[model samples]
Each structure stands twice: as structure tokens, then as C-alpha cells.
Target: MGTDNRIQTIEESTVYGLYHHGELIYVGCTTLALKRRLCFHRSDASKGNDAPIYGYIRKHVDAPKEDLEIRALDYDTEAAALQDLGHKTLNAQAADGAEYEGYDWTSEEIDVLEEESLNEASKRLDASFNQCRRAAMKLGLIDGDGAYTRVDWSVWDEALGTMSDPKLAEKIGCSVANVNERRRAKGIEAYQSRLSDDKVRAIWTRYHALEEATYASVAECFNVSKGTVARIIRKETYQDVERPPRITIEVAKRYHAQKDKSTDKGRILA
Candidate 1:
């Protein structure tokens, strides 16, 4: 079929092709209005996306919009669009009508990631540990020995002595084994949460007193994990701390069900 260049009105839920200098370069399907989807493509490209299509768009960014001849067709799904477009364009991966797997990090992004702790970098850059590590190695920022050069264990003694190996490992962005090896060398025991006995008793009291007081909320309030709050409620760790009388555990259990149901409903709505 020949390219249709006369259409000016772009409707919703269609497949579109972006052509530059009469050469087909990219094919995409969007449930949003075609005009809005095209705007998004331009925006992402301007923001330095690493995809082939975005890279092409960046090259022609200063040119007139009509230069990239957008052709749209009414298509039900991306697979249908791919079948029609003949899979010859520059798509980063196969589109089975779901979220794209994997991402390509820019060199600048990897450089910034290498400066932060593993956990901090992962959250800040929205890249996994393995992803950051791989990008660093690919950019020649780290040596091929697989050893992370960013961590400094000299100042980690206090944390190593007080926190659990797993928790410390997560906070400092290293492996649990590494934390364990360091702690054992210093003759430190496993983490016993440093929350005081008074704080422990307060967590139990708050859980039974408030209908909205979940293990999570109580933990956040006291700066501890939900698991630690559960252990407190069950009198597992702080057996010395006593619960206030007439406070039934069944109340907390009922609220837990309510919280879980609301969370699930929110996910479905989203």
C-alpha cells in the first residue's frame, strides 16, 4: 500500500509510522489519541531517550514537524500494527502489547549512578543493581574483576556492630556476605534492633489502641521494620515489655484484612 499523506486529523487507538526523508524509520501503536502520542515521542526524544526511534527523532529535532511524515492507521493492537508494518522499522524490542523489558542507560546516567551507593543509585536511577553494574562495566567505569569500587567500609563500623548483616547490606548497597564477613572480623553479633524497651512497649500499645495502626504504620512511626513490630506485638523479642490490659489482638487482625482489601482494590482501580 502507498503512503497516505493527505490526512490531517489523527484519531485515538491507531498504529502510526514515522517517516523521515521518505524512509520508514519507526512504527508504533498507541491507545491514546495519535496527536498526543506523537507529542510524547517528541518529548521523550528531547529528553535523551536511548531507543533507536528516539535517537532518529533527536537528529531531526530542529526540523519542521511535517518533515517526519507521520502516517496513522486504525489498528486494534500492536501485534496487528507490526504485522502490517512488516517489522522492518527500528523498535527496541518486540511489542506484545505490554511493558518493555530492560532499559538502556545513558553514559551520563551511569556516571552519576557510579557515584551513589548501590541501594541509593538503584532507587534514584530506577535501575536494578545488576543493571547499574552491567552499565558501569560496559562504560569501562569499573574494572572487569566484578568488585564494586565505590564502597568504603572504614566508616561502616558502627552500623556493622548494631544492624543486621542483611539490613546493613541493603542500606550500604553491598552483598549480605560482604557485610557478614566484615562484622565477623570485628566480633559483632547479628542485629538486635536498637529501639528501646519503652519504644517497644509503645508500638504494642499503639497497634491495639488505633484501628488504623498497622504493623507498617507502627514500624514507620518508630523507625523499625514491620517484622520488628510483629515480633513486638507477639512478645517474641521484648518479652520484658508488658502490654496494656484489655487490648485484644483480634482488633489488629480485623484491621489488617480491611487494609489488605483496600490496597488490592486500589491496585485494580489503578
Candidate 2:
């Protein structure tokens, strides 16, 4: 997924040392505003958010606010600190506890699992944080009280895997031939290509935008080849972007603002 334009630099004081039961469980280094991230953790814990680490904290400990200690870890590079923590987490062994026995934190067998867990955590944090900021612009908080909406695609490409291209075309009110042509313009081989959730969300959002204004309109607005817009809408090729459920309008605004800034700064292009 693409990074947001609102990216902030991390300082030494921003790194946080995390401990469980007075023992170091992990160290988290982030470029997100410290106060914001901490608040997110607390709010997420209350809402049972879908973050692996947050879920782990909620499940393994009671009163995580009190049990899980957050201390400052001075580091020149927060990313490096996070990497070190991952390596340490992969190397450390867990001992039997009053609540559980033979807890192996660093089992070679589960190394892949640990790595996947860490990567998921990173992705979740980035997405959630961006969505929260966007929501805050229009809504005070991200709420789960909205109606559910699904996007369907119509055109299908064998290379893209198993996506229903015809259904997508029907949903978007476009011809399958047009969809396929757009995909070809974007060099997209299939409709159901393996893509990250973020990319899927971006494609959906873009497609919806095009639907609101028509494909030609969106192509003109983005100043890209019509085929590019069509391919994106058709999911021929996916672009990574953050997607958070129950995201607020404020967060969306922030996301757009960041995207615009990135484009202007040559950090990203449509």
C-alpha cells in the first residue's frame, strides 16, 4: 500500500517500550503521533478492534492499561528499533506462567507465524490510524452504525484469478467489453488477481468515484488515460491504499489531502 502524505518523522522520544507482567514482551516504534497512537490503542481495546497485538493484549492480560507498561525507548531510528524488537521477539523464549505453561515465544516452528503477525500489526496500525484521522474531519469518532455496502465487478480475466467480472460490470452499469478494454489498457490480465485488502478498497473507491461522475469524467479529473481509470475501476491492477471499516469523512479528507500532497511533491502519482 502507498504511504500517506501526512507521514510524520519519528523522534527518539517517540519510541515506546512495551512490557507484559513486568517482562519485556515487545518494543513498538512508530512515526505516528505518540499521543494519537496511544489513544488509539486504548480506544481499540475498548471496542475490541481487529489488531493482532491489541487482541493479544486484551486476551492475555487483564486491565491492560495497568498491566501493560509503556515506557519511552530512545532510538535514533524508530524503524530500526521495531526491527530489533522483531528479531528479539523471534529469539526470546517464554517461560511457564501462573496462567499458562510452556509458553514458547520464539519457537522456530512459529517463526513464520510471528513474522506474519508482526507484518499484520504494522499494516493494521497504518490503516487504522489513517482512517481515524480521515473520520475525525467530519465525524468526531469512527462509528460502527452505518449500513453495509458491497461493490461487485463484472469483467473477468483468467490471469486475475476468480473475480466476477460480469457481476462487477453489472454493478457498475458498464459493458463487459468496455471493462475488458479498460483492463487491457491498464495492462491488467485478470479480474481476480491476488491483491491486498487495501488495494481492493482503493479500486472500489475509485470505481465508485467513476460511477458518480462516469468513467470519462473520472479519467479527465485524474488526468490519466481513460483506460487506466477503467482498469483501476475494473480491478485489472490494484494499488495499495489504506482501508478502515467505519472510517469517518474526516479520515477520508485527510487521506485525499495526503494523496494530493504526495502527488504534488512527486512522492506519488495517480
Candidate 3:
């Protein structure tokens, strides 16, 4: 049908053709209200084919909306509405033209799958690369090449003695997965948390005794987090009390006009 046959206005329950400069940019049928669909086409959504069109409308802050036209079209069937919707048509290619065809594997193709990588075999047999890969995996053809890539672990082990995991990953030209595998094999812990019940008990005891114990003071005393102190005191009843969220500047000043926390007498014992 010619472009002249297209309707100028949008109608309810109609198959719409969105045009830009008289070329059909998109085609789709919406049973919902056409007004809502129009709004949805500009709703800052990046789903599929419409993503680029909506993105352009959003990005060009000064562009005129008048340039594009949304018009109703005539289609005898629902299938016709989708058949000619977009600028380009997607059609299936011949079996030989592509590396894959919808072919069930014979016993022969299945037997020699482990001979090479899935890609190389697919090219040789002129089959679908994805299908061949699936078949290979099911038939245990995936193990022809050993799973591990051999690297000199001696250098990596030496580096691991002093260097961090991230730095070691870069140096060995492998991923963090390999680095972690080496650590696990060598019985090396990534990071050992040094927190103990004895330390927590001491901190809690000292904080409960001192009325002037601020989170900063308790944190400095035990070298632990202020949040940890707050959680222990407020949630678990460490001090049987908790301080206000913020101490008044006057109370803090009365406690100490200026105190250096680095020194021993900076805070109230705790």
C-alpha cells in the first residue's frame, strides 16, 4: 500500500504506523488506548527497537516533535499488522549460508565431538554453532581441552607471600578466580578478622563504667567502630544505657575545652 493510503489521525483499537519524514520507522498494534501508547513511546524506556527512537526524542532538547507523524494503517488481519511493522525484515537464511541448521545429530557427529573446540567443529560440519556446543557438552565432548590453563604457580606463590590478591591477579595475567583457587589450595586465608570476645568484653565494661564515654572515646580506647559500640550498648545492653544521637556542643566543651585524643588523659579513662 502507498503512504497516501495511511490515516492522518490516531484511532482507538487501530494498528498504528509511526512515520518520520514519510518513512515507516515502526509498526505495532495496541488494543489499549492510543493516547497511552503515545505517552509510553516517550516514557524514557530503553526496551528494544523503540529504545533508540525514544532516546533520540529525549536527548535532542531543542528538536521539534512536529517532524514525526503517527498515523493509523489498514491491515486485513492481526498478522499483517506485525508482518510489515519495521524498516527491515528478518528472514531465515539457507542452511549452507549459515554455520547452523536445524539438524538432529547423527551417531557419527556425536562420537567425534571431542575432536576439537565447538566452534571449529561447527565450521567444518556446517552446523549451528550453538546447537553443536550444546550437543558437545551433553556428550562429554567439552573436555577435549583440559579445563585448566597451566601457569607457573611458583612465581604466584612467592608473590602471594607478600602481595595482595588483586595485585597478584594482575601480575599472573589471570583472573581473581585463579588467585582465589591458589589461596584455597595453599590453605591461606584472604583476611582473618581479629575480633574476639575478650576485646568486646573489655570495651563494653570500660564504656559502661564511664558516664562521659562518647563513641569516639570508646572507639579510640578499643580501636573498634563507633557503630559497633553503639550496637553493643543499645541493642545488646552492654552499658545498660545509650548516649543521645548527637552530644550538645556545650556538654562536650564542659567535658574538655580542648583535648588531644592521642594523649592518655584526652578522654575519661574509657
Candidate 4:
């Protein structure tokens, strides 16, 4: 895994260090953006990779990522930092012959996108709900008596317990806080997906039989992405699971509706 004893540098390469409580613990160089590189480290750490940095993060999983500071250094400083930090820095070796890569997007960017989306949604709702209501009435999206656009609360009932507030909001085109408020109001618990063989079969069964059981809704129900549900339905994955026989959509709908109602009742009672 060693390069030809030559340090490789990208056109806009960055040398960065990971610090814990003001002490440097890791050193590396990347052609990628700083945040993007950190995101990759975080992903690898979550996947239980064998790297020392990953092990450190896994051991301190309860601590917020901010506690592990990422600070950029001058291009010429990689060797000095690695030497100064010695074995305490989690580098296998210095940047000699190291290859760095760049990416256009990272998980951190996705989180920023979600937060920005929620902020924009809240702003629109606060500033223009009444105005949009009038516009919607003229466009006939709502009747005259409706002063504001009302979400079909029934549609969200099935989704509340299955997915996180952010996911539910993204799926239903609302703010995370708004989805959270509605869920808490009804005494629904937060989303925590529990996947297993039995759960996979249940997801497949419902999607195949229920007309209202869309990939998005079913994914929400199982706390997975819509793509995951689609892959399961299309047999791209989970090929060993036995496919259940198709049933009437009406019967499926009735069963699901009753199940959701019962689940909601249980939550409220609890």
C-alpha cells in the first residue's frame, strides 16, 4: 500500500490534522475539500474500519464530532506535524507518496441542505401562509372557507412512528420541527428503524398488495430510503426472501389502515 517513496500532491491539496483536547492525534493530506475528507473519515469510522482514527472515533462515539478538531495546515507542514506528534498522530506514515482525492458532495453537505431546506420552509410558512392560502383559493387548490393550507393529517399518521422527523418532513414537504411537533402531539415515539428478515418480508408484502403502499411510504414505515424499498420490490436485493402472494389492494388498504389506527392508539395510551 506504499507509494514509490514519493509524496504526491494535488493542485489544491490540503494538509489537515485531527486534534483531541488540543493535542494532535492524526495527520493527513487530501486533494479533497476539508469537510469532504472529514466526512469520509467519519463514514469509515462508523463502518468499523481498522484505521486508528476510526478506532478512536468509535471509542468516543458518544462525544460530538466537534470535540475532534480538524485544522488545516500549510502545504509544507505535513512532515513536521507527523514528526512532532510522532506515533501519537495516527498516520501510518508521512504524506510520502500519499494519494488524495476530491468529491463534489459529502454527508456534511447533505445535512446542511436539510437544515437550509427546513429554514426556508419555516420562513415561507411564517411569512406567506395566509398569502399562499389566498392564492391557493384563487387557483382552486382549496375551498373559500379554508384560511390556510391544511396538511392531510391522516396521511402522516402512518409515517410518524416509522421515520425520523427530518425524513418525514423531507418526504411530506414540511419542516423537521413541524413534523416533530405533530408527532409529539399524538404521543408518537421517535424513529428508530429495526431491520430484520421478518421486517423485510413484511415490507415486501405490504408494498405488493396495498394500493396506498408507495415505495416512499413503505420506506418510511421501515425507516429506510425509498430506493431501498424499490430495490427490495424489484428483487435487486433480498432475493432469498420468499415473495408472498398478491392480494386485493382494497383488503390491503383496510388492513393497513386498521393496523395504523391500532398502533396510534397504543402510542397515545402509552
Candidate 5:
């Protein structure tokens, strides 16, 4: 970043103002969709986000929802007229009953905490995600349940033996350590590249000579992606290696003379 020239205020939705007990906690200017902007704050509020606004909120009630009312601040001609009842949790200096001082939570705060997620709670409490997560877990707010997709180990075994663990992990959405662990568990050894550049070039030449060869097919044979094949072709590193365009299905059928005999439409020759 030379000067962070990115545009702000995208003329989209945004927060006009945030209110707690009719007092302005924080103000935001945005260009995101109003619904989306509101959703973001509502979501963060629900998650316990620790951004300055939520931190300000934590001082008063530990949760914003109790005295919190989300309204378009533009509707109020003189918002200052709304009473600031001086709720103690809203008291910036009060450390005795606030989350900043002790773990003990007010019933209103606890109610908010229970309603919102750990991430939201963390925001309200101005604590870490882990801190909120642990508290939520302890409080039985979260029911541990996750659906996991099963990987095809048979296909993985084939690829694992030919490709790097990191590559396999990228393809499988698993960690490199997990890939290694799985390999070890399955008694499969780590992959070692035996082919030299010359050998690879030779394979590429031979594969292109065959009628069935295509970028995707060749890439699969070479244990790489199609882009790698395309890049090698573009570099012209393999001179006089004729990489022909893929045969269209229509062209193939016409060349083979598979005529639609029911109609008088006969095949054409190259």
C-alpha cells in the first residue's frame, strides 16, 4: 500500500447512527445497502462484536438489545430530546458491575448474551472469540453438531501417491498435517517426483500425438492442472511439438461417417 487509494462511502447501505438508552454510542457512514448494513450490525450485535460501538455498549448493559432500539436516526428531528437515563452499565467509569472488571453478569446482560452468539457476545464483552466461545460452551448455549462430507479415499489414494501432500490437501480441503497423517495411517508413502523436464516434455509430445489427448486429459495424466498444460504450450519451450486443437464431436462423427440414415443427411469428409 502506497496510500490505500481504495474508495470508501460506496453510496450503498450504511449505519446513520447507533443508539443505546437514546444516547448515541457510535456513528457510522456507509454506502452498502441499508438492509445489508443493518444486517451487518444486527449480525455483529448478535455475535458479540468488539468494535468500538459494541465496547461502548458493554459499559452500560453488557448487551445492546435491552435499552437498544434500532431506528433510522433521520426520523428524529431532535434526537437529543430522548432521555439518557444514565443506566449504570452505560456508565463508562463503573468497573464494579461491568464485564471489564469481573465475570459476574447482570441478568439483562446474561439475557442478551444467551440470545446472541459467542462471536456477538465477544463483541459486546470486548473479549476474544475464544473467550466468548468458552463461556458459551460452558453455558450450554451451543449444541455441538456439525455435518461433515466424506472424502473418497480410493480416489485420494490414487492422487496421494502421485501428488504432493500439500496439493492433495488443497484438493481435499484438509490440512497438510492431516494429509500426512492419513497417508501414514493408510501405509502410503509420500510422493517423490521421478520425471525430469526432458521426460515431461517427451510425455507431452507423445500425448499430443494421440487422437484422444486434450488439455484436461493430458493434465490428468501428468498429475497437474489444465492451466499448467496451457502455460507450457504458451511458453513454446517444446519446439515443433504440434498441440492440435481438440476435435469437435460433430467433426468426429462426420469423419467416422456415422450418418443419420433415417434422414437423407449423409456425412461429409475432411
Candidate 6:
């Protein structure tokens, strides 16, 4: 019964060709089989017509042997098998042609696979966001006033740390625009204060040539719209009108005289 089962399995199995150095070394396939392909490769006699495959195996026997790995192609679909085969062919070509040397060649292949994986992951993320938005709408998380639940700043911080704006906004039960508006509002006071201080210092530090640093230039540095920058400069509370408190010769003389009189009075009292 076991022998009959093994024969039945082999008759129904699908095999793939393995290539080495761009040469077809073996032609075989598998189903839910008893032995792995690598196991066959390791034990098979390298005589007669299988001389080339045997020679290839012999060349690697003494060298540091890399493990043979199998990846599942779509088991029952021709298109899936072809796609996986193409990827495998490219990887094998790269490996045999010294395209990958010294480093982990398998890791490079896996990196390529990971990039393809991310595309699906990104699509799923977007789909999840849409589902959440719909559910939130049903739950009355969004009111008739067009205002959704206010995103906690802490949630925003965590979301920003891990996810993109659209994803974060969806997770936080708000629109992307609302998220941005909240972020700006949260920092507006500090941003405005910094800009105001920077503008005042710019004018003060370059008092000799205040025209050199224009409102437009400062605006660019602060990343605000040019019109906003112009408004900031125009409404700047600290102006160039009050020059730094000056120490004139007359004032200095008066101050010295006062100091001398005070010292003389103290000495006399002592």
C-alpha cells in the first residue's frame, strides 16, 4: 500500500527544472511527495546521461556548500508558477554570474521580494482606513456639524511616529485636513513666537543694514507663505525706531560725578 501510494503521488506530481551556471542541470517536479528535491540531488548517482548535473554537484562538494532552498509557487495556477519562475530565474542568474558575491545572495533576493510585499501591504492599509472611516460614520463619530472626534495629541504623536498622514488621520477618526489643522494650531503660538523673536533679532543684529534680510527671505526660512511673512514684518511690535540706549559723553560724565560724590560721602562718614 505504501509503494502504491508513492507511485500514485509521483504520477500526479509536478516538477520544475533546476539550472546551474545557466545550464539546465535537472528536470523534476513534486506534488505532496515523500522526499524533497534536495534530498534526491544529494543521493542521486551522477553516472551516464546525468553526467553534467553530477559534475556540477562534484564541483561544490569541497567548497563551502550553500543550502538549496525551495519556495512555493502558486500550486495550482499557471500564471503564479510562471511569475515565481521568472523571479527565481533572475535570482539564479544573479547568483551564478557573480552579481552577488561575499554577501548573502539569498538576502538580496528576499529584499526584492519585500519591496513587492510592501505594495500589497500599502493597499491593505488604505483599505483598512476606508473601512474604519465607514464604521466611524455609522457610529456617529462624525457629527452633523462636519466635526469628527478630536484626535488626542498623544494619539497623533504615536501615529506620526509610525504611519503616514492619511493612515494616521483615518486611525484617529478625522480627516487629513483636520489633522493638519490641529497640528498647526497646537504649534502656532510657539511657531509665531519663534518667528517674531527671529525677526526682531534679525533686524537688531543687522541694524547696520536691515534691508539685507527682507521679509520674503525670513519667510522662506520659516516656511510660511510670503504674504504671511510680509504681514509678520509689518506688524512686528519691536521696531528699529528705538535705537539701543546710547551712552553719550555728557551722560557718562554726569554718572561718574555722581559716583565720585557718593564715594567721597561714604569715606567721610567712615
- Which stretches of candidate 3 lie above 4 Å from their native place? 1-12, 45-50, 56-64, 76-78, 88-270
Against the hidden reference, what TM-scores do the models get? 0.29, 0.26, 0.23, 0.34, 0.21, 0.24
lDDT of 2 by residue, 215-259 (tens): 677666655556655766654555333433444434555677687
Ranking of all candidate structures by their TM-score, best first: 4, 1, 2, 6, 3, 5
Indicate the residue-level lDDT of 121 in model 4. 31
Candidate 5 lowest-lDDT run of ten: 3-12
lDDT values for all models = 0.63, 0.46, 0.50, 0.61, 0.48, 0.42
Judging by TM-score, tell me the better candidate of 2 and 4: 4
Candidate 6 off by > 4 Å: 1-122, 125-131, 136-146, 152-173, 185-213, 217-228, 231-270
Which prediction has the highest lDDT against the true structure? 1
Arrange candidates, best lDDT first. Answer: 1, 4, 3, 5, 2, 6
Error of 4 at 57 (Å): 1.4
Q: What does each candidate score in C-alpha RMSD?
A: 21.9, 23.9, 19.9, 20.2, 19.7, 21.4
For model 6, residues 148-265, the per-residue Cα lDDT tens digits are 4455676455234244555556566456667656544443322223345454444333322333566666556656556555534454333322333334434544665687799999
Give lDDT for model 1.
0.63
Which stretches of candidate 1 lie above 4 Å from their native place?
A: 1-12, 60-64, 84-87, 98-270
Pairwise lDDT winner, candidates 2 and 4? 4
Q: Write the per-residue lDDT of candidate 3 for residues 1-270, one digit (tens) a residue.
A: 432211111112456666656666556555333433454554443343345555555554233245555566797433465566533412121111112223555545654445655545666775776556445433433321222224688766645534566566645644456676876566443433224445655565656556677877998888877867765655432231233333433445444434444455655665
Counting clashing residue pairs in each candidate, in order, gives 0, 20, 3, 2, 16, 4
Query: Which one is best on TM-score?
Result: 4
